[model samples]
Structures are given as structure tokens and as C-alpha cells.
Target: MAEFLSLAEAVRRTLRDGDTVAFEGFTHLIPHAAAHETIRQGIKDLALIRMTPDIIYDQMIGMGLARKVVFSYAGNPGVGLLRRMRDAIENAYPRAIDTVEHSHSAMAQAYEAGAAGLPLAVFRGYKGADLPKVNPDIRFVTCPFTGEQLAAVPAHRPDVTVIHAQKASRKGDVLIEGIIGVQKEAALAAKRVLVTVEEVVPDFRGLHPNLCILPHWTIDAIAVVPGGAHPSYTHGYYARDNKAYLEWDGISADREAFAAWMRDNVLTVGPEIFAERVKGL
Candidate 1:
């Protein structure tokens, strides 16, 4: 049986002070809202893993909620540079330990290995690359039968995975559009999986069987909240909150503005307050 919890309760229950959390979403869609709630609750020393670290990760790092971030890339999508993340990389006390730069496919492969209880997965994307410099954990191995070298990427089994989706069944079958391999891999790789959905349907039969990305067994908790993505967006539903992203981008560029925004929006405010602030945008 799948448990149904409110977003706040789910986040409060699953997150610890220091844990590795993989977030679902691309550059600007379906960010894990409950993960942000956890960050705002003062969870410290979090290691956030993502394909690309964008506004949410940047803000968390700036506010001192993140200790490390493992990602393939970190930048403002379609915008300029991610000023806050760049500054933190260059400055900030107790600098962040960033990891190897690999494609999303490679990261998903690593998570799949972790989910399968494997030590490592070897491939050929690191022979002459600089990823080893960023993450020395990767090892090169020789295939005895094939007599070829392969890059050994260790599994990234996270403590938890927080994913936002379009819809879910009452029984916890997640329905998401488009590519879901990464989300599925993250759910399987994590010890616990929490999903925030825009809405809840009655049963799995209502959804197209082919669009069923995650089965009920993999999900630990489900929270139904419309507009759960906030700054992000749901595919085939709405566009991203461009105005909100612009505000975040502006605040992220300047220290004082960013500090004020964090104190006003993140540290002092709860989920309700944050939602209210994003109402117009």
C-alpha cells in the first residue's frame, strides 16, 4: 500500500540534516517542491544531485543549505551565467564539492547501477575527458574479453528522491509525459521516493498504460498539490514562470538582493508564503 501525505509532512518526514537527494526536472520544469521545503526547514549539509543545477540549487547554495552538489552542469538555462553558483565556486567558506560533468544519460546509468545493487558501471565516455579531474572517483578498467578500456562510474544511490509529476493515481502510480527514464532511475535508486503531483486521479486505468512511468511499489509517498512546480512548469500544461525566473535571476546576480530575497522568501517564509509570493508570476 502506498502512503499519502501532504507535501509538508512528507518532506518533514523523509529528509535528514545531511543527505544526498536527487531532484527530478530538466532546466525549468518539474522541480521537487518538497525538496525546497526541506531546505527551507534548515536541513544542513545536503548533497543535491541533478542533471543541471539551476535556480533552486543556486539559491540553496547561496543560502548555505547545500554542502555539495553533484551535477553534469550548473547554469541559468537560456539566460546568462548562474552568478550565485559561480561566485560560490570561486568564493564562499567551505567550498562546495562538485562532481564529474557527464551527460544526463550517464548520470541515469549510474543511478540505475545503484538501484541494481551494483558496485559500478563501465562505459567509454571518459577516456580522454576531464571528468576524472572533477570526480576522481571514476576509475578506468580494461575489458579482458574485448581488450578495451571503459570508464567505471560508481553508483549514486541517494538517500531520497523528490520528484514532481503531472498526475498520479490514488494507488501511487505516477503518470508523467515524455521521457521518464531519469525520474524512473532516480526513484529506483533512492531509499525513499516522494512525489508531488499537480492532481490525483482515481485509478491507474484512467491513464494511458504506456505513460505510466513509475509503478506504485516504488513510491513511498504522494502529495497532491496543484501548481506544485511553481517556478518550473508541467509539460503540455503551462509554460515556466518566466517573470519569477527573471526576478530570481536579478536577485541572484547581486549579493544584497539575493540575501534579502532569501531572508524574505526562503528563510522566514513557509510554503504558503512562498506560494503567495509567486501568485502573480
Candidate 2:
């Protein structure tokens, strides 16, 4: 039997103070609604882990929800650095634990190692570069036979993996499009997995078998939320909320405006209010 929960309940069940949460999706395709809900509920001491952190990270930091973040880059979607994130770094208020800048391919490989229960994965990208500078924890190993130096990235087992998908079954099977490396690996490596989907189908039979990215057994909870990935997109569905993001980008530049936005949209507003505000968007 599988457990079905609302997005809020799923987040409440999986997240805790001082937990390391691995979030799926890229910059514009991030799961902001759930993250926002987490912040609204006041889940403190969160450590965010991502290949590249962006506006969502900045918002979390701005709202004082994130205590630590491990990532390679933090910036706006198309614009360069995110203002609030830059402010956070410049002031050194919310601590940042930086990591090596790796291509999406390399990041997938590292998470794959964690999923496969391996100690580390050896790759060839560490020579004569600044990667080692960002991630000093990565080890440099030489093959005995080839005498070739390689970068060994250790497995990262996060406390929780929160991914927003296009569709899910009542039994917890998830359907995601495009690359499933991070989502798949995170599902396998994390102690618990919480999936928020735009729609909940009766069963897997209605969905294309090939589109089923994750099986039900891997998910601890399945949350049915229509706009779960707002500010992000669901493949074959709606596009990201670019207008909302642009608004956030503009207001986030000013401390007073950012605080007000957070208070109105995030702190005071509940899920119902958020849904109402984004009804036409």
C-alpha cells in the first residue's frame, strides 16, 4: 500500500529542522510553491543542496529560512547574479557551503553514485582547473595501471528529496519528462522522498509507461497539487511563471520591498491565498 498526502502534509512529514533537502529541477523549472509553503510553515535550519541555486534559493535566504546552501552557482534565471543572493553572500549572513562547479552530466554522475550505494565516482575533470578550489573535499586519485589522475566525488545521501512532477498515481508512481537522473538518483539516495504532482491519475495504465520516471515504491508520499511547481513548468503542460519571477527579481533588489513581498505572499498568505493570487497566472 502507498501513502497519499497533500503537498503541505507531505512536506511536513519529510522535512525537519537542520535537514539537508535535495531539490529537483533547474533554475526556472524549480518547485517554488512547495518551497514557499515550507518557508510559510516556518521550517527552520534548512540546508539546500542543488547543482545550481537561483531565485528560489535567494527567496529562501531572504526569508531567513535557509541556514546553509551547497551549490556551484547562485544567480537569476537569465540575468547574472541574483541581488538578494549576492547580498546574502556579501554580508555573509546566511552561511554558504560552496561546491565544485560541474556540468549537469557530472552532477548526474555523482548522484548516480550515491543512488547505486557506491563510495565515490571517478571522473576526468579536475586537472588544471578551479574545481578543486570550490570543492576541496573531492579527492584526487591516480589509477595504478594508467597513472591517470581523476576526480573522486563522494556520494551525497540527503535527508530528504523533494521533487515536483507532472503527474502521479494514487499509489505514488511519478511521471516526469526529460532528464530523470537527479530525480531518480535523489529518490534512491534520500532517506525519504516526497513527490508533488500537478495531477493524480487513477493508475499508471492511463499514462505512457515510458513517461513514468519514478516507481511508487521509491516514494514515501504522493501529493496532489494542481500548481505545485508554480514559477516552474511541467513538461507538455504550462510554462514557467516568467511574469511572477520578473516581479520577484525586481522587488528582491530592495530590502523593504522584498520583506513586504515575503510577508504578504509567503508569511501571511496560506496555500489558499497563494492559489487565489495566482489564479489567473
TM-score per candidate: 0.90, 0.89
lDDT of 2 by residue, 1-281 (tens): 24787767878888998898888776333677778878877887777877777777788887767767766566777656677767766775444433335555456667788788887877887578776677665678999899988888777678888887877766667888754536778778888888777787777675556774688888888776666667666665566677776777788889898888888877786555534444565
* Local distance difference test values of all predictions, in order: 0.75, 0.72
Q: Any idea what lDDT model 2 has?
A: 0.72
- What are the C-alpha RMSDs, in order, of all predicted structures? 2.4, 2.4
Among these predictions, the greatest lDDT belongs to 1
Q: Please write out the lDDT profile of model 1 over residues 176-279, one tens digit for every residue.
A: 88546477777888998988887788876655667746888898888876666777767755557777777777888888988888777666755554355445
Root mean square deviation (Cα) for candidate 2? 2.4
Clashing pairs in 1: none
As a TM-score, model 2 comes out at 0.89
